[model samples]
Target: MQIKLIAVGKTDDSSLKELISTYSKRLSHYCNFSFEIIPDLKKTKNMDESTQKGKEGELILKHVNTSDILMLLDEKGKSFTSEEFSEEIQKKLNTGMKQLIFVIGGPYGFSPEVYQRANQKIALSKMTFSHQMVRLFFTEQLYRAFTILKNEPYHHR
Candidate 1:
């Protein structure tokens, strides 16, 4: 199955971008992988947080498809260990789903509509993280999950 990661806004730190790219490349070997970035909304100074979140949610939803499974990366979502995460990936793979889409919303977080549409919600940790930083963290974890599934040494038990 193809796995796609969709994150809001660009990464300003070149180092983080490079690292995210590195893990994304490693993911290509195990599955059809792609990373997508939704540009940040412009001129948000006048808008309220809810409005900005709504606009960002629209852009995020535009990349999704009715047939695709949408997973939101949110703080209040399910938390799993490395081994358990691999099992989640295995469970998704077994479904024969065409694609599994994961989204990292903007700073204001996801809108109510977005949350309603999501099939699953997952959290990397209880601690808060910047949206840009989450991209790299999530990508590496994804790569690590694949390695664990393959019985590779990348993930030590």
Candidate 2:
């Protein structure tokens, strides 16, 4: 299955971008992986939090397909160990999924519509993380998961 990570906004830090790129390249060895960045919403100064979330949700939904399994990286979502995450990835590959899309929403989080559209939700950690930092962390975890799946030494029990 092709795995896609869709995050709102771009990472401005060169270090973080480089790290994310490294993991992304590593991931290509194990599976088809794509990282898509949605441009940050324009003219947010006049909009309320809910309005901004709604607009962002609309953009997020545009990238998804009806057949794709959408997962949101949400604060309230379920957290998994590295092994468990690898098993989940294996399950998707075994099931012959076309695309597994995981999304990181905007600063205000996802709207109700986005939440409803998601097939599942996953949380990286209980503590809050910046949107940009989360991209790097998530990419690393994805690489780790793939390594675990392949019985590689990159991940340890």
RMSD score of candidate 1 (Å): 1.0
Give model 1's clash tally.
Answer: 0
lDDT of 2 by residue, 54-133 (tens): 99999999999999999999999999998998898888788777999999999999999999999999999999999999
Question: Model 2 off-target regions past 4 Å?
Answer: none
Tens digits of per-residue lDDT for model 1 on 1-157? 8899999899999999999999999999999999999999999999999999999999999998898999999999999998899999999999989999999999999999899999999999999998888999999999999999999998985
For all predicted structures, in order, the TM-scores are 0.98, 0.97
What TM-score would you give candidate 1 relative to the actual structure? 0.98
- Clashes per candidate, residues 3 or more apart or on different chains: 0, 0
lDDT of each: 0.94, 0.93
Deviation in Å, model 1, residue 81 alpha carbon: 0.4
- What are the RMSDs of all candidates, in order? 1.0, 1.0
